[model samples]
Target: MPIFVVERRFADQLEASAERLDGINRINADEGVRWLFSFLSADKRKTYCLYEAPSPEAIRRAAQRADLPADVVTEVSGRLMPDGSPVPIR
Candidate 1:
């Protein structure tokens, strides 16, 4: 599996898009998405998403359903240690 991170700028339709993502996650079990984490900037005008999916395309489809900007989505690779810290050796 691969990880995709979406760096998002606020949009008028953000709330609606988030709602759609919830539904997508509920039904797309075969995609092997391990988890999805979303964070809102302190100013509330920006956001980011971390996703674990079987491949880049899986994340892409999920992002499209959520109305994420195509240019902002990117793939990343790494892992976390048992103590919840990212492995920095990469």
Candidate 2:
């Protein structure tokens, strides 16, 4: 699977209520899109979600099913760390 970054912008402040978040999780699982995590802006108007999917289209489909906005979907590949060094897995 390829990793994708999905960006969503809201007209007003956004808050992921428990019910909404749960629905998102359910949709992700049902659509076969792995929702690794997400980062919401401090102002709560924007959200950046990281997901692993077969393709960008898969992500879009999942967003549609979830009834969430998919402003931009970008494919990305990289390592996660403070530096560029790889950390040993236990």
| After superposition, candidate 2 runs with Cα above 4 Å error | 80-90
Candidate 2 displacement at residue 21 in angstroms:
1.2
| Model 2, residue pairs in steric clash | none
TM-score of each: 0.58, 0.81
lDDT value for model 1: 0.65
The sequence of per-residue lDDT tens digits that candidate 1 reaches over residues 1-90 is 567777877654345466676676764454566456778787766778777777767766655664556447677876778989886322
Candidate with the greatest lDDT versus the true structure: 2
Model 1 stretches with alpha carbons more than 4 Å out: 13-21, 27-34, 79-90
| Residue 85 accuracy (lDDT) in model 1 | 85
How big is the RMSD of model 2?
A: 3.0
Tens digits of lDDT, candidate 2, 1-90: 788889999888886689998898888888889998889999999999889888888888888998789999998876568877865321
Q: Supply the global lDDT for candidate 2.
A: 0.85
